[model samples]
Target: MAETLATYEVPEHHVKMYTANVQAALNKEGGILTPLVSSNAYTGEKSQVVNFIGEVEFVERSTPYGDTKVTELEHTQVWISGREYDCAVFIDRLDTLKMIYDPTNPYVERFREAAARKMDEIIMSKFFADRKVGKDGTSTSAFGSANTVVHGNTGLTVAKLRSLRKLIKKRHVKVRTVRPKIAVTAEDVDNLLGEVAVTSADYAAIKPLVDGEVSSFMGFDFIPYEDNGGTSGDGKSIPSFQDSGSVVRQLPVWVPDGMHFGQWDGLTIKISDRADKNHIKQIHGTFTAGATRLEEGKVFQVQSKNAA
Candidate 1:
């Protein structure tokens, strides 16, 4: 005897449940860098312009009541345009009937994971890319080369961390105020573990080898992030590159304020039956967002060999 077929209809409550699930998943796994950067929501705007005021020199008073020295404040801006990202999946009515369980949950997980990775990719791309500056945001400013720590044909080590810290400190960025963070891959963490100073109990209180991760060292929070050689809109892997016959991973060390994420629309989901396509259920998720480097001094890159 054949199994009795019954009509399936998506409940309104089910749609709300799925939407909440997607939003929660995105917030939880939407990349390590997204939560660490400056994020803002916008309405009716294609792009966001962040204004920066340059440092002003304080003139010492030479006379008791001398004329005030007239000075102009330097103004620059960084423009971040929103980009749309989405994922869709369809489930045939027959497929749903044959399956023992609903497949929508698995598809939702995949979408959230991919979207999370994409968010990180956007941030990593902007770390070293040129920024749109000037009052009208028409001019372009290259990332300061002086801020980069050369690979030196080696993987990440304490020496590089110290050098990176020194460079940031030279810019007068206080650790408490700036809250510096460094994005590193598993290979980079392994290299650090191999070093005596990092793993050895004598040098540090926290043994990275025992913990199986580098939580924090040298006043910088170490965040494990895999680049996967992903490219941005400009078709460049700003996070890693080939140099000196070696694949160099461009790890970014930055303060939260140095990078920005503008969200035109937060993660949203829609599920409905496609009437024209034999009533197949469609799961669609999308978000409009963009990222940009806010300041050159607040962001720095550490280039290290990607090696075993």
Candidate 2:
């Protein structure tokens, strides 16, 4: 059955909840097919912010001349030391999320291709590409969009039907939920339901705005330890100051918000173009949920390395 959402209205005390069930469904190293990170939280026109988030640690070693070259390599193991990453979630005013139920709408046949592109754009911009525009509207991709597509087959494959069975596979993006209310809201929405991507709001509280107030204050924390005592990168216990306030705090991006009550919109989509193509390639991810729905209760706890 089709679900109806209110017309672009922000609930006074309600916060928006958008959870993406991220899974590396299929990956290719040689790049026979292009990989697009999918999440409903991105715009189809540009790239999403890709962050190589981790921590830095140094070990004391000696050199031949009795001199030490203190090398530092980032460790992605912040969670092991009870530490959260410093991350932020920024929203694009350009991307859009609208449910299409009109049967005569030609786009429905392609299986939410626009939504998938939006997801890819969001991930690529953040994790891979930064931004892709200016007033003149030019692509800002590092090497450009064509660069992301490393492998391009020039000639059509000439093979027997029997021999191609192993190579040919079905393509589809089917999100199954009894109700279809998969929508996303801006970060400004306070007290949102479901999980969230948070960042520090450059606060100038002294000179406040007249209409709205910035509410959803979020952050993260970790037990960062120096070689304070133990030989094994043992970080001493530290206070929880994840991302907010500009202190030496943890920048927690996926700050779970609101109660996981009512029918939830697990994924978000920001449509920028109408994809009328037949072929599809997508990249997708989620915060801590590896082939699993994050129980609303699980957000507050420091357990579960939800990665696959």
Candidate 3:
């Protein structure tokens, strides 16, 4: 006996609730490169150009008063574009109405978690591809193979931070006025600052180090982000930046709104019941977002191990 199927339209408020839940979960993860990049809300899926102030030279004064040479303010442009991400989850017809009433439904939480993870992967994979560190640690040009390491066996240290500061300065990136941030993975944190020699004087001097809390170091805020284990646009697993790894990729030191760009239409949600033969209802979340390293010099990547 075939059962009669009917279309069920999810209420507006219910859709809003799901959107809010997913957005909240996404925000909680915090951003490594996103916060430090230029972003804009765009409507269409066309190519957009993002501008940045470029290096300019001072004009020399002439003895004879001639027309002041008109020098155009220097600027550079990077085309910002993004791809769409859509995730759909099926909910049993029996509990569809129950979901609208109960915000604490397990299915809702599961969907939120899944969406947030995918969002992280999309952004981080772009970061890994666009803002790569080359074999020569001193090269301040573009992304290349992960061949440079920050600290040898010592991992991240105060000295390494100072070196990073120097490299940023050399790149002509101004860090004296606005301090840049250093983003490290959970693995890097453990290898770098998690351990302390109880008998050492350095351990006794700093209470946070002794207590295992490292919030800020060397004038830069430390952000701990777990590396993504998911696949990237190329269908390859996202690489790790841990010590003794084959591909030595790790955290990057970035100036806020300096090197990266994000083109976004934001995230929109839609509900449909006619699809899937009405036997299974669906909730879909769609987002059009993309990220790029607008300035190679502004983002610096360091390896977990020493370049041998």
Best by TM-score: 1
How big is the RMSD of model 3?
6.2
> RMSD in angstroms, all models?
4.3, 26.2, 6.2
In lDDT terms, how accurate is model 2?
A: 0.21
Candidate 1 segments exceeding 4 Å error: 1-7, 51-72, 92-110, 197-199, 202-214, 229-238, 275-277
Determine the backbone clash count of candidate 2: 33
Q: Of 1 and 3, which scores higher on lDDT?
A: 1
lDDT of 3 at 151: 49
Candidate 3 residue-wise lDDT, 128-230, digit = tens: 4643223322223346433233545555665676777777777787766777766565555555544444436544433353243446556676655553444
- lDDT agreement with native, every candidate: 0.74, 0.21, 0.57
Name the weakest run of 10 consecutive residues (lDDT summed) in model 2.
77-86
What TM-score against the true fold does each predicted structure earn?
Answer: 0.81, 0.18, 0.72
> Alpha-carbon error at 225 in model 3, in Å?
1.5
Please give the clash total of every predicted structure, in order.
0, 33, 1
Candidate 1 lDDT over 1-308, as tens digits, reads: 44322346566666667667766778766776788999888767776686456678888889999999966776677888788988877765444433313335565577778888778777777887788776666788888889999998899888998899889999888786656998777777767767756456624533552454547777888877654654533312446667756788778889998888888867777776677776767777788888888877899989889663
Better candidate number, 2 or 3, judged by lDDT: 3
